[model samples]
Target: MPLRLPPLPALRFFEAAGRHQSFKLAAAELNVTPSAISHGIVGLEQALGVELFAREPRGISLTASGADYLSYVSEAFSLIAIGTQRLPNHRADRPIALSCAPTFASRWLLPRLAGFRARWPNVNVSVDTSHRQVGFPVDGFDFAVRMSRAPVAGTAWTRLFGERFVPVCSPAYLANLRDEQGNADLRRATLIHVNAASEDWQAWFDATGTEGIDTAAGLRVDTIQLAFEAAAMGLGVALGRRPLVDRDIDNGTLVQACAATIASTTAYWLVSAENADRRPELFDFKRWLVSEAEHFDTHANPADQALQSTAN
Candidate 1:
């Protein structure tokens, strides 16, 4: 017997709208207009001979029937997704898509990626670097590395590491700052500021008990990467995050200008949608990321080494 069913497009539209509980959000997820979503839901309701949503002054709400139908629809989609993921060839050639902050990508992750590639030669990885907050499935990102104090809502989160900030400058710049008494006077130095990380400098100053250095004065750059580069070029002293500037300090491009370190309230987090763990590749990637973060925290303490060197 031939089976009768609602239009696939209308069903898909209804599923999206019901899941999000907002037509506008559904439209964004489906890459269509709100009007189209409304029309599709209307057609779906007509086909089912029931009202799926109730029109209201502020927005729309799901009717009793719609809520019941949504449970079944959502379950069906989850089953389909899980089944597809379990297929033999599903992970064979598909790439893992990741989103990360630009400075973290360039300064921290990029250096370690070759190791990941070497370990998992068959698994291809693609990274997108941006400051915009990722929206998981809606934004088409498999997962993200975010700097935050806590876990993001509606996602599974793993804390990676905390941030430690220290003052850094080129060796030549530090040498030039030394007076006849051998005291490095930071008030006379040009402070390089990261526009987004203003608190870093303030915290460093408070920790070091230094005073009268103008926080507003400096060559302001938009990203930590640029600020580090400017400081390495002998422009001025820049507050450097430990993880990002570890290599630069080791390589002698930058030196610690101050011994005081400030521990940030926030830390790095690995975030992904609830369903991301179902795929074996994503699971493997997550485990690998956690391992790498642990290793970094254990072995990468350039800030401490820098302070010790200065004391000696």
Candidate 2:
């Protein structure tokens, strides 16, 4: 006699939906349409002869049976993942997937990745720079870097670094400032703002004690990287974050428009599942990230202190 199983596809969809507590989110994780998720769940309910979800106007919720089913399904998947990871070739060839913010991916991590690659030549790394918050193992990401004011629950997370905002512009743009008076009359200059970091300019202004400038008047860009690029092209002065714009400043493409800087409440966090660091490659990457962040902090502290003093 052979053991029977429910439809695997339907089971998978059910698992995702159950775990996320939302069909739409499950669809996103599985890279399918919400209708597909709904159909799969419907088929699953029919196959099992049980009502798994309680449908509501806004969304769906798992019933008692669905909640119970989810635990077993999740454990089975975890076991399979662990089994595959134990394979020798799987360990060697599997790429570590990391999710990050687009601006941080381009402005900060991408520039520093060469060092990681040089040190670990055999370890493959894949980075996803979508704005969507990653769902960890379900989303197939080994880890993620997120900018957040507070730590996300259920995941092991480390603070990479806090952010500080300072006004930056192309040297040409600064030079073209009327009467070479630095940032004193910034109201007359074009301002570049990143929609994602909307509060930065106002924060900088408050810290510097500069008044009467309209913080909202600017060329709004979607990402800090785009704002930096615009400022580099002499489009406008942009409020740049420390560490992210350090390379541009080093290369002389961007210069401080003023001495004032504002510390941001938000910080970059490296987040992963509790067991993710058990893998040697992932552990190595985590260690390297911490070391890099430490190195940056050491160098940035002096300027940060000066900014703090001025703000005080």
Q: List the residue pairs that clash in candidate 1.
A: none
Question: How many clashing residue pairs, candidate 2?
Answer: 0
Measured over all alpha carbons after superposition, the RMSD of each candidate to the real structure, in angstroms, is: 6.7, 4.3
Give residue 264's error in model 2 in angstroms: 1.5
- Give the Cα error of residue 269 in candidate 1, in Å: 0.9
Return the TM-score for each candidate structure.
Answer: 0.70, 0.75
Score residue 7 of candidate 1 by CA lDDT: 90
1-312 per-residue lDDT for model 2 (tens digits):
998999888988988888888888888877999999999999989988999999999888889988998888877776666666656667566788899888788877888899999999999899998666565465667889888888978788889898888888999888777465434358777999888763678777776688988887879888888989999999999888887888899899999887667788888899985557678898999999878988987888898888667746
Question: Quick one: RMSD of model 2?
Answer: 4.3
Off by over 4 Å in 2: 1-29, 33-92, 175-183, 307-312
Best by TM-score: 2
